[model samples]
Target: MAAKDLSTMYGLSESDPEQKLINRAGMSASDLEQIDRIMAEMGRMRQIERRIMRSSQEFMKLNETDMRALRKIISAKHAGRSVTPGELSQYLGISSASVTKMIDRLEAHGHVLRTKHPTDRRSQCVEVTEETHLAARDQVGRHHAKRFEAASRLSSEERDVVIKFLAGTSDAMESSLGSPLDDDAR
Candidate 1:
């Protein structure tokens, strides 16, 4: 089989000057080339993330929001806490009614259960079913564990630098939205 062309998948190579922004004052071609390579890696990571999301959604038979809800519930469970519909609504930035509908859908699919609140008799708690939890752990959870391993392999200084770079990138994206993201939204 012919070798696949990565340039087409990853956009123009660093050697293509037209693909890069105007070079900053005092920056050499070498600097620009490095920046282009970094941006290309970022694009590759984004594409991989999209593929992973599609595969996870398909395998789990759930939409993005459903998967996010499940993740929140799993987090809460790990923290030794129970989640309520109201909490889910707040976390998801959706209306209570919408959260109720989502819960209904999840419950019907046997992914979650509505259990009586251990502390509050007036409210109920949401729990991930054992089967669903195990499945998620076996799939997405395992993937994330690999990510943790990769991050752990980085030196503390390297991790700090990565953290700062990612934060700056996130801030730039939020700024491009024409308004700052709210603290709660973050």
Candidate 2:
């Protein structure tokens, strides 16, 4: 079908900067509304994530990086892989000294353990304490697993569209920044 001509009645208010761009691009008010709705939903998701991060930090008496490291360790453990301080430093994008300090803090809090690497004598492996492992499984892990239910409810075609949209949005942001954001971190 031929696209509708919307050169004349683009609906944004005069004070809105997007008003002229919408008209020039021949976009309809409905298209703008849908974009606005998508942005609003993304904003809400970000807010929820921030809340969860803050809550997790406060409850665990740890900072954001500490929580992140713990999660990384937990994930590696679950995958039957060992995490080393050097790897943590690389993964966290920080210096080895900073990684050492963070590991010290976590160890002091009984959240993690430092052990000799089974095969590498020169390297040490980091592991979350059982207490920490169970707490994380019960808290952040449980919270994240709930998302699977939402995905499972979607039809395969719907899921594909959602995936495409998310990837496109990510690509757009990365392009605008002239670099991929955390390509390895994810």
Each model's lDDT: 0.83, 0.81
- Tens-digit per-residue lDDT, 1-186, candidate 1: 343333433333444446454436686778755665667677777788788878988998999889889999998999999999999888888899999999999999999999999999999999999999998898788878888998999999999999999899898888789887643335
Native-referenced Cα lDDT, model 2? 0.81
Q: Which candidate wins on lDDT?
A: 1
**Model 1 Cα RMSD, Å?**
4.2
Q: Give the per-residue lDDT of model 2 (tens digit) for 152-185.
A: 9899999999999998888877898996676244
> TM-scores of all models?
0.83, 0.86
* Poorly placed runs, candidate 2 (over 4 Å): 1-24, 183-185
Q: Worst lDDT window (10 residues) for model 1?
A: 3-12
